[model samples]
Target: MVDADQTFVIVGGGLAGAKAAETLRAEGFTGRVILICDERDHPYERPALSKGYLLGKEERDSLFVHEPAWYARHDIELHLGQTVAAIDRAARTVRFGEDGTVVRYDKLLLATGAEPRRLDVPGTDLAGVHHLRRLTHAERLRGVLAALGRDNGHLVVAGAGWIGLEVAAAAREYGAEVTVVEPAPTPLHGVLGPELGELFTELHREHGVRLHFGVRLTEIVGQDGAVLAARTDDGEEHPAHSVLVAIGAAPRTALAEAAGLELADPAHGGGIAVDERLRTSDPDIHAAGDVASFPHALFGTRLRVEHWANALNGGPAAARAMLGRDVVHDRVPYFFTDQYDLGMEYSGWAPPGSYDEVVIRGDAGRREFIAFWVRQGRVLAGMNVNVWDVTDTVQRLIRSRAQVDTEALADPHVPLDSLVP
Candidate 1:
């Protein structure tokens, strides 16, 4: 049972934190709802940082989850640009910054998000070296793209993950010659597998983005305190006017660790360990978004997803759980990306090499297709690229767990729904 008078304090005013507050208000928890965020701006979508925002296709005003007035209307006490310095779990209070401002709370929600993983190579701290994780980074990079005047500037991108690739695409769109470096045999090999990774490789190649796999960066060469080039172990030197490091991210778990909350094993990527209900080891505490590692019903394994949809969906689910509502916060893992003319939507998670076969409908060469991963004739995961209005059918195919006929699924003529039902 939830006490209406108990104060609810939410840390990290990102998507998850904002959504959790929205859920609390919607669920009739009228007590004081305090939202704390280190960023100066309101909670906004992150995907735009690499796509529309970076490319100048969208305005910053449209990125916010809600305008400043909305939080005031909901009576949510919004604290921005304030870092939580300490959490006194025993006293049920949190300390803010150097001022030692303490706030008492009956219940706490940890939505602390992830931050960009820094490159360990030498000269990484030099000027012209950048990483994109927050709105500020994107805004800075937008100016860098403007500086790189089209067709004359060279930008070197480190890593080939979704963020790296999207930033590369945006840079190239701005007329910079972009080069992507990946140490793996193929980009995104760990997540999407080499087959699809190579498809993306082709997409980048067609867009005039040079890709180098199976190579590691030795050092970032700088001239006069500014990055000028990067050298690789493979004896290749990339002359870059600007360098963007997109090498993954690490979960912001310092708060959870300091408070002695149980965390996922280091081998499991290290996040706050939570049950399906999003409750931490302490029932009075809850977690959501990238920081929380919960059991995945569809994946049948403990999974931590760092996607927009995960934060959007998991926040509300955790809020309900915090309110003592009986809820199983399990949903299919879903993510999407846009690169050049290719728009990709992927639903479900099957461990790499676990899927028995991949059935394709439509043409991969033409940049339009739906790829389905099957295990023992049952659909495990599906990806629809440049094919709109089919995610519902694909998600149903995965949740239903009904065996599918590969022949009909691969046939473009057969409707996806027909095979599932």
Candidate 2:
């Protein structure tokens, strides 16, 4: 049982922490909910940082998870721009800042998310080189992209992940020449497979975004601390005034590691390890979102998902688990992305080689389709691309895991619900 008079400290002010606080209150915990964030802004959606927000289609204030008044109204304390220096699990307290202003908690939640992986190459510190993870990074890159547009400049993008591709689309929309350098044979080959990646390849090529597949980036050449071009290992150089690195992100597990939390095996993409309930080794401490790698009950392996939906869903589950409820974070992993005019929503877990076949519905040539990964006739994963009002159906198909007829699954005339059984 938790003491009603005690405080509940939540580290990291991202969506997971904010949602956990909301869950604690909604579930009638009524204890002190203190959320600590290193960033100055209130909790906001990070996806917009590379997409709608970067393109200026969404306002800065609109990105916040809740308004300033909402936190006060909910009786949640927001410690903006405050760094949590250390955690004393034995003492049930967290120390912050150089002064080490210690805050003791009856229960603690670690929602510290992932950070962008940086490049080790020379000229990475150049003025025009950028990485997008936070709002400030997007703000700076937005300005740089706009400047490039006005000057009819070029921006070199290293890596072809979602962020890189989305930003490439935004930069193209801003009328700047864009080139994406990828070490993989196909962009997003690991996740989308070669077929879907080839479709994306066509999409970018159609939009005049130059893509260099199977190319290794050697370095970013700069003039007077400003980017001039990106040199490839193959000795090819793409001229540019700005460079954006979007390789990938590494989970921010320093605090968890320092505090002696059990970490996942490094071979499994090292992260703070937690059970299905999102409870860390310490009974009073919980972890959620990107930093916590919990065993995916469906996939039979631990996964740390760096997606908004995971954070949003995992938070409430962790909150419930913290409140002495038997909770399993068993929700299907879902993530959505908007690049150019194409919007995509994917659900379920499909480990590499787990699926025997991909059954795609609709016209792939037209860029409107739903792709499903089937293993032993059961739907393992599904993705709806440029499809309307079908994500719920896709999720249902995945969760139900009913042996679906590949023909019916691929039939446009057949409603998705009809194939559910």
Mind giving the per-residue lDDT tens digits that candidate 2 earns over 1-421?
A: 7657979999999999999999999999878999999999899889999998899899999999988899999999899999989999889999997568999998899999999899889889988889999988999989988998999999999999889999999999999999999999888777777767887898888899999999977899988887889999888999999999999999999998899999998666677899989999988899999888889767778888889999999888999898998898978888888888888888887756778988899988888999998898888888889987888888888878688889988999998899876
Stretches of model 2 off by over 4 angstroms after superposition: none
Per-residue lDDT tens digits for candidate 1, residues 1-421, read: 5666789999999999999999999999988899999999999989899999999999999899989999999999999999899888889998998588999998899999999898888989888899998899999999998778564888999999999899888888888888999998787777788778889999999999999999877789988997789888899999898899988888899998999999997666679999999999988889999999998777777888889999999989988888888988788889999989889999988657879888889999897999988899999889999999999899999999898889999999988889877
Whole-model lDDT for model 2 versus the true structure? 0.89
Clashing pairs in 2: none
TM-score versus the correct structure, for each prediction: 0.98, 0.97
For all candidates, what are the clash counts? 0, 0
lDDT (C-alpha, whole model) for all candidates:
0.89, 0.89
Ten residues in sequence with the least summed lDDT for candidate 1: 145-154
Candidate 1 steric clashes: 0
Model 2: how far residue 176 lies from native, Å? 0.7
